[model samples]
Target: AKLVAATHNPGKVPEIAALLDGRFEIVTAGQLGLPEPEETESTFVGNALLKARHAADLSGLPALADDSGLSVKALDGAPGIYSARWAGPGKDFAMAMDKVAERIEATGTEDYAAWFTSALAVAWPNGPAVVVEGRVDGSLVFPGRGTRGFGYDPVFIPAGESLTFGEMEPTAKDAMSHRARAFAKLKAALFD
Candidate 1:
C-alpha cells in the first residue's frame, strides 16, 4: 500500500516512514507536488487532521500528517503550535534555539522545563480520519547540542537522558521521541 505523508518537511518523512515499519510505501505531499495547507487550527490534532484531509482529498489516497512542537513550561507552552514559525521563514533552528535561550533569560528564572508534543492524524480520501497525540517531558539546554535531529532537537534533553535528541543516534532517539510515542498509539489503533 502507498501512504501519503502529508508534510513538505523532508526531515519528518524518514522518521515517519521508519515508524511505519515498512507496512506501506511512503510518499510525501512535497513529492506529490501537493501544496501545504495552512494550519489554521489552534490545536495539534486539528492541524494534523487538516493537513491529512487536504492531502488525502487532493491525492485520492490515504494520508498521514503530524503536527509536532516544543512547548516550554517556563514560557507557558509558548511556541507550541508555532514551533516551525519560530525558526523563521528559512527554518533556521540554530537561530530559533538562540531565540529560545534569549527568551528564557528574559524570564529571569532557571525553570527550563519543557516538553515535545506530537499529534498524528490519518485520513482517507473523502472519508473519515483518526487522530492521536503523544508527549515527552524534558528540559532545555543552552548553546544547543549535537546535529542529529531536526527542529528543536538540539536544545531538548528528554527527561531521563543527558544527550539531546540531536546528539542521540537516530534509532536511540526514535525509541523515545514524541513522534515515536504517537506512532505507537497510531499503530495500535490502526495497524495492529
Candidate 2:
C-alpha cells in the first residue's frame, strides 16, 4: 500500500522510510504539492494528529506524522513543542543550543537531565486515527559534539550512552532512537 509521510524535511524522510521500509510505498507531502499544515496544538499528540489528518484528507491516503522534542525536567518541559521554533525561522540549531545551555547554567544546577519525546500519529482517510509515543531519557551537555544528527542531537546524550546522538552513526542512533520506538509501535499496530 502507498502511504503519505506528512512532512517535507528530506532528512526525516529517509529516517522514517528506513523504519517503514518494505511495508509501504512511502511518499512525502511535497511530492503531492501539499502545503505544510500549521501546528497550532499545545501537545505532541495534537500536533501530530493535525498534520497527519490534514495530509490524509488532502492526499486521500494514509498519512503519518511525528512531533518530537527535548523536554528538560528542570525547565518544566520547556522547548517541548517549540523545539523547532526555539531554533528560529532559519532553523539555526546552534543558537538554540547556546540558549538552552545558557538557561541551564543560569540555574546553577548542573542537573542536565532531559528526555527526548516523540509522538507518532497515523490518520486514515475514513478511519479513526491512532497515536503512539516514545521517549529516551538522558542528560544534556555543553559544547555540543559530533555532526551526525541534527536539532539538539549534539548536546543530548541518551541514557547509558557516552556519545550524543550527533556523535553516533545514523544506523546506531536509529536502532534505539525515541522515534524508532514510536514508529515500531505504529508499525506493529498496522502490520503485526
Candidate 3:
C-alpha cells in the first residue's frame, strides 16, 4: 500500500517511515507535489485531520498527519498550538529558544515543567478518519543541548532522563517520543 505523509517537514518523513513494517510505501506531500493546507484548526486533532483530509482528498490515497507541540506548565500551556509560530516565519529556533529561556528566567522558579503532545490523524478520501493523541511529560532546559532532533528537541528533557531528545539517536528518541506513542496506537488500530 502507498500512503502520503501529509507534512512539509522532511525530517519527520523518515521517523514515520521507520515505524512502518514494510506494509506500506510512504511518500511525503513534497514528493507528491501536494500543497500544504492552512492549519486554521484550533486543536491538534482538528489540525491533524485538516492536513490528512486535504492530502487524501487531493491524492486519492490514505493520508497521515500529525500536529505536535511543546506545552509548558509554567507558561500555562502556551506555545501549544503556536509552538511552530514561536520559531517565527524563518523557523529560527535559536531565537525561539532564547525567548523560552527568557521566560523561564523571569518566572524565577526552578520548575521547568513541560510536555510534548502529538495528535495523529489518518484519513481516507472517502471520508473515514481516525485521530489519536499522545503526550510525554518532562521539562525544558535553557541553552538548548544536542543537535539531533529539530524544533524544541534541544530544550526538552523527558521525564526520568537527563539527555534531551536532540541528544538521543532517532531510534532511541522514537522509543519513547509522544509521536511514537501515538503511532503505536494508530498501528494497533489500523495496521495490527
Candidate 4:
C-alpha cells in the first residue's frame, strides 16, 4: 500500500514513517508535490482532518496526518494548537521553549502539570476522516535537557520518568510517546 504522509514537517515525517514500518510504502506530501493546507481549524483533530483530506484529495491516495502540541495547565492550555506558532516561521523551538520557561517564572507557577496531545487522522480520497487522540501526562523542566527528540522534548518530563524525551533513546521515546498511543489506536481501527 502506498500511503501519503500528510505533513511538511521534516521531524514528523521520519517519526510517522518509522511507525508505519513494513506496513506501507510511505510517500510524503512533499514527494508528491502536494502543497500544505492551512491549519485553520481550532482543535488538533480538526487540523489533522484538514491536512489529511487535503493530501488525499491532491494525491488520490490514503493520507495520514497528525496534529500535536504541548498543553500546560498553568498556561491555561495555551500553546496547545499554537505550539508550532510559538516556534514561529523560523521554527526556533529553543527560543519558544525559553519563552515557556520565562512565562512560567513570571506567573510564579509552581505546578508544572502539563501533557502532550496528539490527534491523528486518516483520510481517503472519496470520504470521511477517522481521527484518534492520545495524550501523555507530565511536568515541565527548565533549561531543556538532553538532545534527542524535537520540539519541547528537552523540557518535558513524563509522569514517571526522570529523563525527558530528549534524553531517552529514540526507540524508548517511540514506545511511550503520545503519537505512539494514538497510532496504536489507529492501527487497531484500520488494520485489526
Candidate 5:
C-alpha cells in the first residue's frame, strides 16, 4: 500500500521510514507536493491528526503524521508544541538551544529535567483515524554536545543515560527515541 508521510521535514522522513520498513512504500508529502497544514491545535495529538487527515485527503492514501516537541518540567512544559518555531524560520536550532539554556539559567533553579514527546496519528481516506503517543524522559544539559541528531537532541540525556541523544549513533538513538516508541505502537495497531 502507498503511505503518505505528512511532513516536509527531511529529517523526520528517514527515521519514520526506517521504523515502518517493509510495511508500506512510504512517500513524503513533499514528494506529492502536499503542503504542511497549519498546526493550530494546542496538543500534539490534535495537530498530528489534523496533518494526517489533510495528507490523506490530498493524496487519497493512508497517511501518517507526527507532532513532537521538547517539554521541560521546569519550563511548565513550554516549548512543548513549539519546538520547531522556537528556533524560527531559518531552522536555527542553536538559537533555540541558547534560548532554552538562558531560560533555565534565569529560573534560578538548576532543574534541567525535560522530556521529548512524540504523538503519531494515522488517517485513512474513509476510515477512523488513530493516534498514539510516546515519550523519552531525559534531562537537559548546558553546553550542548554532539552533532548527530537535530533540534534539542544535543542537550537531552535520555533516562538512565549520561550521553545526549545527539551523541549516540542514529541506529542507537532510533532504537529508543520517542518517535520510535510511538511508531512501534502505531505499527502494532495497524499491522499486528
Candidate 6:
C-alpha cells in the first residue's frame, strides 16, 4: 500500500518515513503536490486528524500526519500548537529559539521546564481514523546548540540527557523523541 505522509515539511518526512519502517511505500503530501490544508484545530491531535483526512480524501489512499511542538512551562505552554508559526514564514527556527529565550527571560525566572508533544493520525479514504499522542519532558537551553535536528532541537535537552536534540545522533534522538513514542503506539495499533 502507498501511504501518504501528510506533511509539507521536508524535515518531518524522513522522521515519519523511518518510523514507518518499510511497512508501505511512503509518499509525502508535498511530493504529491498537495496544498497544505489550514490547521484550524486548536490541539495537536485535532490538527493531525485534519491533515490526515485531507490527504487521504485527496489522494484516495491512507494518509498519516503528525502535529508536534514544544511547550515551555514558564511560557505557560506557549508555542504549543503555534510552534510552527513561531518560526515565521521562512521557518527560521533560530529566530524562534531566540524568541523563546526572550520570553522566558521576560518572565524573570530561570525555569526552563518544557516538553515536546507529537500527535499522530492515520486516516483512510473511506474508513475510521486512528490517532495517538506522545510527549517527552525536558528543559530549554539558550544560544542553541548543534545543527543536526531541525526546529527547536537546538534548544531542547531531553530529560536525563545533557545534549540537545540537535546535538544527539539521529538514532539516539529517535529512540526517545515524542514522535517516536507516538509512532510506537501507532505501530502497535495499526501494524503490530
Error of 2 at 28 (Å): 0.6
Candidate 1 lDDT over 81-147, as tens digits, reads 9999999899898898888899989999999999999999999999999999999999999888899
Residue 128 error, candidate 1, Å: 0.6
Superposition error at 136 for model 1 (Å): 0.6
Model 3 gets an lDDT of 0.90
Q: List the residue pairs that clash in candidate 3.
A: none
User: Which residue segments of model 3 deviate by more than 4 Å?
Assistant: none
How many clashing pairs does model 2 include? 0
TM-scores of all models? 0.98, 0.96, 0.96, 0.97, 0.97, 0.98
> Which parts of model 6 have CA positions greater than 4 angstroms off?
none
**What is the Cα-based lDDT of residue 104 in candidate 6?**
93
For model 3 the local lDDT of residue 166 reads: 90
Candidates in descending lDDT order = 6, 1, 5, 4, 3, 2
Identify the superior model by lDDT, candidate 3 or candidate 5: 5
Q: How well is each residue in 14-36 modelled by candidate 3, as lDDT tens digits?
A: 77888765578898999999998
The residue ranges of model 5 lying beyond 4 angstroms of the native Cα positions read none
Error of 6 at 35 (Å): 0.9
Query: What shift in Å separates residue 67 of candidate 5 from its native position after superposition?
Result: 0.4
Candidate 2 local lDDT, 2-105, one digit each (tens): 99989866767877888786678998999999999999999999999999999999999999998889998878898899999899888899999998988888
Better of 1 and 5 by TM-score: 1
Candidate 5 per-residue C-alpha lDDT over 1-192 given as tens digits, one digit per residue, 9 for 90 to 100: 889999988878888888887678998899899988899999999999999999998899999999999999889998999999999999999999999989988898978889999999999987779999999998998899999878888999998998899899888889999999998898899879
Greater TM-score among 5 and 6 belongs to 6
How displaced is residue 116 in candidate 5, in Å?
Answer: 0.4
TM-score of 1: 0.98
Better-scoring candidate (lDDT), 1 or 2: 1
Candidate 5 local lDDT, residue 120: 98
